[model samples]
Target: MAATKKGNTEQIHDLLYQALETEIGGVGVYTTALTCAVNDDLRKEWQGYLDETKTHKQVLLTVFEELGLDPAAAVPSRKIVKHHADGLVAAMEMAKKGGDPSAAQIVAGECVVLAETKDHQNWELIGLVADKLSGAEAATLKKAYEAVEKDEDHHLYHTMGWTRELWIEALGFPAVLPPPEEVKKVETAIGASRAEHARDDMLKHPR
Candidate 1:
């Protein structure tokens, strides 16, 4: 069977749907990560992100309504995104089954970072789409992007720090707990660079 072609609006709708599901999975991922996290500060941070991810889904739902897109409609691409999330969940479970609690925590951290990497890029692309739109559609997507962009940034950046620091310790290398700077809260390019520098400085005196 020939595949149905999609218009620009249809494409955007599918992308939004994909992003919506990813955010939904994000909440679960963060919740699971918190369960395995031994670091109090990291656990606290994941808890906050889990909350933000929930709100992000609501924001996307509102955007769907504004665009007259049905949130319940199934899209193939979204199924792929969901499967990826499922894979992450299974990996965490496998780690736990092995009785390696620390490995499980690291796996969860890595999964959150992976999920957020896609989530962050999705919003950035949506921002570009918003710039090309007009009137209410533009307003709706732009608002949604602005509302979640910073949180998404924090999820990707901060969790990435946790993943790295955790791995460093796992490898018997001196690692900084709670990384010198909270990279997750960083939303700007310059902020990311600063966080990198902070990590470098901390690595010199790992606890």
Candidate 2:
């Protein structure tokens, strides 16, 4: 879409809200998973990741301010993050429930899928925005988006790959797919949270 300066600003505003939702959802998942992780290393991996996502949130909010919005008052709004996080949590739960290598592998596969999907989604959104945005502003947002997307790609290709192999070695195959209803529940909860949070962020960062 050809964007006028005003249209570009509005589009970016909408995207920032989406980004906020994602950051919160990611943070929530990491915090929750930290409570149940069996390995110190896994806990560390996610902990560091949460910090990265938090940084992304701050940068995007700042970008909003540069665009002339009151960023501190603005809420971040990436609802998809919750759904993605829920998938990871469900995988962890699956590992505990079956106590079998195959089940664990299956769960790990799910995590890989989630991570990969996140990488693609964020890259595309930010890249598109970069294309539409001008000069230093576009460069700023694209670089930030690339950083987070790269982290997710690493998790998908490395952490999740090892996890899947471990499952194959133990169970010969994956054990289960997440139930649709469970996913639906998470979507509803996170989506509601996103709406409320977006309103809060806008209030804090007013246009």
Candidate 3:
């Protein structure tokens, strides 16, 4: 039993370390993404997300303090996480340098979606881990998860909607700008799907 518990705790520590690195990479991703954003609304939205990503980093730092982990400790998984993040940033940069603002915007959206996918999954796992833990550890993780959960959902789902709509528009369809997901403020997978399905109606009604 003791061995099992130690293994679980070690695994949780690795996750937290990766989560911290994800947020750090997220900040860079959003910052670069903003440069590629042509739509005023998308730019505004990403700016907000950038600020929130910064806050999420701070949240993880606090979690490390409470859990007696080193926020800056060298972890093997963290190096891989940073590599992925840096690659995302580089992709956006390459797209931006291609000299097509619209194409770059789409590429940026794709990168954001990829980064947010990881971010959302990390928080989801954290929530699950928190449910299994008890005492101070559980409380700390729960607070961190709760604080960032909604934002992670919004970041992933809404960006997905944006990326899909942008692709539709690029394909020369009459795509709805800002997407139904943004207008409806979707925060769940189901809600995002529903909003996406309703896009035809949104284009027709144009509210």
Candidate 4:
């Protein structure tokens, strides 16, 4: 385990190295967004942001290279990983013990919804931060991540709308679910019903 930890330290060095690379990679995503953007306002805004991210990548990469770290090393934080694994196990165990498939489904749905909400909120927060930025640090984050602001907004808007459509389609329930027992049975039967519909929707529309 000590040896693994040592290796992870080495890997950690690599991951930071790769994190800079990831920043470098982000430029392309931003640039693509800039090119594909139809709105002039977005084009300039996205391009400005990509340019900033590219500069950030270059600066950090130079610093990493100066520090003698391998530019492509991997880093692992065992503690954090173990904690996450434990949390997942505990959550699953709780769900299983509760024996409520509707709750499980709701949990899954909320995770997705919460993640999307966070992404949307991040844009507003970042944009607010950008308003207060100045000098090199400000320029670095704003210009580089500028596209990110737009991307974040786009992501939240499009995903929220798409998920809303999907949510409505998937769950047009009249109001309350059936009793828990029936809910569990129906949840268990979802896959079977989907398959039946695929086999013949007309025959199973009300099934």
Instruction: Judging by TM-score against the true structure, name the best candidate.
Output: 3
Task: For candidate 2, give the lDDT.
Answer: 0.55
How should the candidates be ordered by lDDT, best one leading? 3, 1, 2, 4
Choose 1 or 3, whichever is better by lDDT: 3
Q: Over the stretch 1-207, how does candidate 4's per-residue lDDT look in tens digits?
A: 656422343433443444454444445444433433333443454465467556655655554555465555434443343343344334534554566544443333333333334434533443454455445434544553465554444333332332333344348632211212122222123432443234233224323
Candidate 4 stretches greater than 4 Å from native: 1-110, 172-207
The CA lDDT at 51 in model 1 is 89
Q: What's each prediction's TM-score?
A: 0.90, 0.57, 0.97, 0.34
What's the true lDDT of residue 2 in model 2? 60
The clash number for model 3 is 0
lDDT by residue for model 2 (2-46), tens? 647425666566666666555655666555555554445555655
Error of 2 at 78 (Å): 4.7
RMSD of each: 4.2, 15.2, 1.3, 17.3
- Residue 51 in candidate 1, Cα distance off native in Å: 0.4
Better candidate number, 2 or 4, judged by lDDT: 2
lDDT of 1 by residue, 144-180 (tens): 9999988887788778778888999999987778864
User: Model 1: how large is the Cα RMSD against the reference?
Assistant: 4.2
**Which digits, one per residue and each the tens of the lDDT, describe model 3 over residues 131-203?**
8777889899999999999999999999999899999999999988898999999999999989999999999
Name the Cα RMSD for model 3: 1.3
Cα TM-score of candidate 4: 0.34
- Please count the clashing residue pairs in each candidate, in the order shown: 2, 18, 0, 11
